[model samples]
Target chain A: EADIYQTPRYLVIGTGKKITLECSQTMGHDKMYWYQQDPGMELHLIHYSYGVNSTEKGDLSSESTVSRIRTEHFPLTLESARPSHTSQYLCASSLGRAETQYFGPGTRLLVL
Target chain B: QKEVEQDPGPLSVPEGAIVSLNCTYSNSAFQYFMWYRQYSRKGPELLMYTYSSGNKEDGRFTAQVDKSSKYISLFIRDSQPSDSATYLCAMSGQREAGKSTFGDGTTLTVKP
Candidate 1:
């Protein structure tokens, strides 16, 4: 089955902790994206990748970074987590730039 | 003003009722519109997608786009408890289809 997966569905970390969220898709998509969303709030794009070795910062400036080393994997890392970083991180992939995106189950991070 | 604006609705309705969700955009260049549904603590799943200005219906879900007014809507007939979730509206232009602008989602609950 074609699907996107994110690990560590729930996380709790203290301030200044380094953390990484893993995202992978089995659909062999070329476009991948990372979005930050608060519970019942708007979603903000944080990072995206057009293809392997191609990455760009999204509309919302984020403190995290992302890498697209392979077509199936796009991981997000926070250098130093803060309480303000407590939010849900969503990963999504698309076959093409104009195609609809399929999202993962999401990783919820709670930084204390 | 924001590129896309959506009312943050925590709307509660009885089961089998007709439910409507909407969003308005400030950009006239937007040509592609989409709706995504997110359950509690989960990533958004694409529900409806349309290009240009028109209406598209699939099963009990109907998506409408009015480019002249820069607005879009989603209507769900005979809403069920499974329909309880947050609905997000996203839009982008044909040329820059990868950079989609998203609106704040509206939360809906269908009670049995």
Candidate 2:
């Protein structure tokens, strides 16, 4: 099956805790993206990767960092979580720059 | 001003009604337009996609793009209770299509 997966659909943790959100896709897509979306707000691009060993920061600045060691994996790590960092993280992938995108279930993180 | 603008509406309609969702963008470079459906606490699922200025249809959904007017629309016919979700509009430029701009989703509820 061609799909993208995100681990820990829901997470709750105290502030200042370090956390990593995992995203993997079996579709062999060249373009992968991570987006942050809050309630009733638009999605903000946080990070993206074109392929293995290629990663770039998106339009929105964030304290989180992403690594694309392999083509299938793109993980986002927050050095220290804060209460203001609580939001849903979505993962998406596409075959080409102008193609349609497929999304994963997403991970909802809560920093108390 | 924002590049893309959408009405974040909590629109309610009876079953079998036709639903219309719209989005406007300030960037004329955008040539790839898409519509996505997102359930509560779920990732967005692609519903329809169109290139340049034209209409594309699948099942009960139709997506329209007007590059000259810098506008796009999605129409859903015979709305059902299962259609209750948030509709999002996204677009990217043809030359620079890797990154897509998304609109603040419009929440819709279909009653029986």
Clashes of each: 0, 0
A1-112 per-residue lDDT for model 2 (tens digits): 3389999899999999999999999988888999999876778999999888999999999999999998889999999999999999999999876557889999999999
A-chain TM-score of every model = 0.96, 0.95
Q: Docking category for candidate 2?
A: medium
Worst 10 contiguous positions by lDDT, candidate 1 chain A: A93-102
A11-112 per-residue lDDT for model 1 (tens digits): 999999899999999988899999998877788999999899999999889999999999999999999999999999999888776757888999999999
In model 2, the runs with Cα more than 4 Å from the true position are none
Q: Candidate 2 — which pairs collide?
A: none
Off-target runs (Cα >4 Å) in candidate 1 are none
Question: What TM value does chain B of candidate 1 have?
Answer: 0.97
